[model samples]
Target chain A: MKDLTTENITENVHAINSQCQNPRTRYIFERLVSHLHDFARETRLSTDEWMTGLDFLTDVGTISTDLRREMILLSDTLGLSALVDSIDHPRTGKSTEGTVLGPFHTHDAKEVENGYAIHKDPDGTPLLVLCTVKDTEGNPLGGVQIDVWEGDSHGNYDVQYPERDGPDGRGILFSEQDGTFWFKAVKPVSYPIPMDGPVFNMLQMLGRHPNRPGHVHFLLRKDSFDPLITALYPRGDPYESSDPVFGVKESLIVDLSEVTDPEMAKKYDVKEGTSLLTYDFVLVSTRETLKLRKEKAEEAIKKMGRSMEDFQGLPILDVD
Target chain B: MKDLTTENITENVHAINSQCQNPRTRYIFERLVSHLHDFARETRLSTDEWMTGLDFLTDVGTISTDLRREMILLSDTLGLSALVDSIDHPRTGKSTEGTVLGPFHTHDAKEVENGYAIHKDPDGTPLLVLCTVKDTEGNPLGGVQIDVWEGDSHGNYDVQYPERDGPDGRGILFSEQDGTFWFKAVKPVSYPIPMDGPVFNMLQMLGRHPNRPGHVHFLLRKDSFDPLITALYPRGDPYESSDPVFGVKESLIVDLSEVTDPEMAKKYDVKEGTSLLTYDFVLVSTRETLKLRKEKAEEAIKKMGRSMEDFQGLPILDVD
Candidate 1:
């Protein structure tokens, strides 16, 4: 029968929620309630302000659809998506770093062979993408699966155009015996995140831009290896540094240099001066990934001033 | 061009948001981002977990409509609504404390004279409500407008029954010259919050019961007095202690006793065993409310390790 003041309501909430049967759910909710209460208290959040926030969240949810996920966009703009990705997929032993899987990705990208051009139209600038997959020891690994997708030169994904018939600027390819895969696609251009939603409204209110850096998304997987979800931001995109989603990383940014050699163009069957993006991905085995994650979990537990036992029932990326 | 590791992302987010022109928006966002990132890092929130939360929020929003406000229900269940109410309307002196003005309040309550019965049917136990309003010095506050509403004996508000026409169990009344008011209404019974939404689903997951204590809502207003939005829970309700919305306070709980006096029941136009609930409300002037809020803001800022300058542009309830 405890009365709830602003000071004691947090603990009251925790005590009430402690009846949850799942330990991980309880622990996550405990921290979440603590931070939520702390945020309200620290800001001395007004009733009006609280209502405003709730309304914004509701609007974000209402505006979301299959083609547009405003909730994920909200997370991205607030940096939670990036934080989760960073924490979940920490780089280990020269492995490729992962970034947020932005909502634009679709599961139905067209599959193509090596040296195939994914673009069906000539509206976008020609770009030659050359990628290689290797182990942490720099040994080429053949037959790895690569899923690549990017916005067109005009900064719109195929999904953004309801009139478009099929996927464009995206393809699935398997690494050749030399651990190399080449594909010709449009050069991605910096694009504003969807503007007709509460996320963009929030960004405008915060004096922040909604544009993400020009980038290509890559999803790589192989047997017994940790999958890589990453993006390569073109080096000179204006929004590179202040990517609204915070998905950019130093190692993931790549230079797009022009290849003016007519011999190279003839060999690739493309026009001269086509841009070339060359990058090699280093993959980490599942065992190494597990070790790194365990170490990270321990470090995080120590930093949180909590024993590992407090997180006992929580999953630690149990890929097995 | 800072790399957004889990460690540096919080500050990077703050830096990017610093371009906000409004100091208050900037400050609020700074704290929000800090806590959001902290929650993610401390919990090591996974991508799947993040997506689950977003989906839950989306469902909550989708379930809401004009008659139902699941967002406010979310705030209430999470204790944020109560927290904000306590912060906004702290009790000063002997003034009555405020609680959440829940989403069921409608503006179209029928105006009635004191002692008028708000119920259109005879379906519940009769109750006589006697109320008086006074200032801090105990001076009677005549001509005060009091808006009162409550759930029926079946534990459903008028709004919850779509087929029911107009407002019942609710009325607007003005105090007599002696600052006294009386009314005949159904004795409110404990009721579950709307159970068809994500909030209820969350409560179920958290092992919580969704019932609120039997209560009546009062909204008091006058020319210079701070408007009071509060509710009175009947004593001895089983759910009083753990109101799902955390709206119950010891001071707000009232004694409801059976009154068997035939003369009294006849006078109040009710049965012999009608319950009687008598409570007095103390109102704080708008000036006092502002002063109290300003002091609270200062205390909160100090506790937040921030100076008053950081909150300079924010409104402090300037009723004038």
Candidate 2:
């Protein structure tokens, strides 16, 4: 029998590499060729089946938008997002536990004081969240900046709302002299991923569900430490067993308990039955070179005319 | 030195396959694992760069729509479409040359008699096309059904028009007892693929053009012979050398000549300067099993709730 698979992949790799302008692109193309070839060899994949996969991908591209980040969803659903995240943020003894940043981090968030309210909607039950920044040694890290965002009670983020302005429910707050930060906002509710795009359609075709657990977003940064961008999910949401993007981590879960202290509530200007979530974030110092490298990578993408909006959305997974 | 690549792929494949229900699903997943692994090996690809590629794919999925087939375009641009077409239509000595069906073919066109007008829009110059169907032995194949569709001057198909019902500029015409079929329609002009989607964005990023040559679609069937689903391009088009979809075939090109005869114009009910395209289609009769197999494969997709409209607005390449 003829070994056509090797020939096909070699030719494909050559063609792709020839068309690429940069070393990175050439590297990616070459890998793509090898992998595609290996897939063909492993499955003895028929030509027609391969065509169908191509068709599926084309539909994926067509359904993508500024609000619906189907490509990111695809990666997340495929578990590639978590894999890449883990590999990029390899554990270095005491480094913070890394997680997927997700596709909803919109820039241009309002800069506010330490205890400002990020939510403008007055629908959900109020919650007070007190966060503190600390080094691995448990020393306070003052003057650190923390960016936060989360969905509303209905599980819809501010960006999902039409009338919202510039990163709804999103803000940048600096830690106070004691390295503590507090914010008043509504408790996030579990929401379904956007099911109107091809990702949803594909999930349905594959017999999967579209639900993600309740979670709050955070991006923390301080001098001499690696910036951490992650999400904290509710401790026991039903969907915690299967986050569509596989973003869940044991250490990232925060407990939200109801506090009935009238005096404490009055001091924080909250009602008696308000919910409170308290958690302290731990960071690890890293070489400035790594930070500079990340900044340069981001700068290159921006200079290439791509925006954060171009990369936001839910993952496509079998929600079974 | 740790070789995480093989171990990671094996673990993922094992997990995914354990969860898969069918052989086909398991096969596809296993292939995906191997391909991803091969890609990593070929380039020693970085996690961040891989994440960027994932981001690109996510955008592709987000932009897909019911009418615009971006995933199909991505496949075509990547040459996967051509590869699948080649494998599915492997030269079996007597089979019709198969090409990419593309993302623009509409389902269930109106059945019209020979010589009927298929074009609803009168903006472009009129063209009368004369076609004949014949067997490999040069004998006419009477009563053969020919389904036809073509893009307009702007490279937009009738299905792309919001106001159109069912398939526009798309219909089925049967050959008469003389094995001749004729249709009245405007001449298709080569146009650029939709630049609004990620496929176009990718092309721009890669410094590639998104042009395809003018072509007409057809799907011919007869009880005694093989059914043919294919497209024919104009003999000479500027972008024929770099057809975006790579669907063009030398034998499929037809000559569109200017006709000046008044009687000929009167017969076709067109003006003096109207162009006339004449082409004879020769089909080869293969084994009955092959024909049935192809039909069964096509039916499987149809059973999966796929319609021709699912493939609208796709780029059709010029055959050199």
lDDT of 2 by residue, B1-320 (tens): 01122236346434534454444655466447555644443333345677567667766666665666667777667665655554444444444565666767666688998778887776867788888888877788898989888887667887567786677677889998778999987787897777777778777766567888888888888886656767877777887756766677666677889769998888767788778888787676646535543454444334434422211111111112
Candidate maximizing DockQ: 1
Error of 1 at A122 (Å): 4.4
Q: CA lDDT, every prediction?
A: 0.84, 0.66
**Model 1, span A175-214: residue lDDT tens:** 9888888889888889999887788889999888888988
Could you give candidate 2's per-residue lDDT for residues A1-320 as a string of tens digits? 11122235346434634564654555456446555544553343455567567656666666665655667777666656665555444444454566767767777788898667788778987888887888877888888989898888888887677776566677899988787898888887888877666666655554556788888888888877877777777688888766666677777787888768888787777888888988888876766425433443344335434422211111111113
**Clashing residue pairs, backbone N/CA/C < 3 A, model 1:** none
Highest lDDT against the true fold, candidate:
1
**Location of the lowest summed lDDT over 10 successive residues in candidate 2 chain B:** B310-319
The residue ranges of model 1 lying beyond 4 angstroms of the native Cα positions read: A110-112, A115-122, A162-166, A259-269, A310-320, B107-112, B162-166, B258-267, B310-320
In order, what fnat does every candidate score?
0.79, 0.30
> Residue by residue across B109-158, what tens digits does model 1's lDDT show?
87899999888757888888988999998999999999999888889888
